[model samples]
Target: MTHIVDAAWQKILTTYGEPVPPDASPLLEPFAVLARVAHAEPLLRRLHPWTGMWELHFSRCTEMNYTWDLPYIGTLRDGRYYVEGPDRSSPRIAETDSAQAAVAMVVDRLPPGCGPAFLGNAGELAAYEKTRDQG
Candidate 1:
């Protein structure tokens, strides 16, 4: 069965166009690994519209579904993968020359109890969270 996160990512690909595959550019291998390994989480992946860098973020309940302001992964000019903190001005959380290492760092930092994305609007997600919390 297709996971909810995989379906969400398919929608993102159809909407924003596909990112170049890892085979096409070695720098993107970590992104590919992240997508594969984190297939069950509430994560969304995309390419930055302006920078064309691979980006990852938690799935949100907004119209876009992606929490764009969250921490994301990008490749440095020197061919290392780095996870930037929440905003552009925020410092890098981790940087590594190995794709596995970078992917691990991103996985380790996922938000607590993120689970599968709600796949709904903010109001619905809020309701779900409230119910989940109360149970």
Candidate 2:
């Protein structure tokens, strides 16, 4: 799953002709979470052509089966690159140069005052946001 991200990043660059400058690790955070969910959870119920962008079809979802398709960090036919976040209660679409910020967007999309996301801790989400803000 980790290795798949690099290839997806390459595709993002080729399609948009814009590689995320400096570093892509932060931008890839959401993708990492998607991979983790795929390995760790069994309730996720969706797949394919995430938000009509690059592969990494893994998408955002809740244990109850709610899901949202997203872009890992790529352009659509409209020529915009984004790492889209979940829209269960509301939607969040972010455009940024920092990979970490992209991760933060995903975290921010999480429902507030909730306990035990699929991973079972709010701090984990906070940690991702910390990385995003720090970057």
lDDT of each: 0.54, 0.38
TM-score, prediction 1: 0.56
Candidate 2 local lDDT, residue 62: 24
What clash pairs does model 1 have?
A: none
Give one digit per residue, the lDDT tens place, for model 1 in 26-114.
Answer: 54545555545443343333222112356655544433433444566676656667888666788889888855566567657667654
TM-score of structure candidate 2: 0.30
Model 2: weakest 10-residue lDDT segment is 40-49
TM-score winner: 1
Q: Give the alpha carbon lDDT tens digit for every residue of 1-135 in model 2.
A: 223333443443344344445665443444443343333322222221132424233333222232343334443333323554443343436665544454444445435432222221234445665797899
Scored by lDDT, model 1 comes in at: 0.54
The regions of model 2 sitting more than 4 angstroms off are 1-52, 55-66, 69-81, 85-92, 113-135
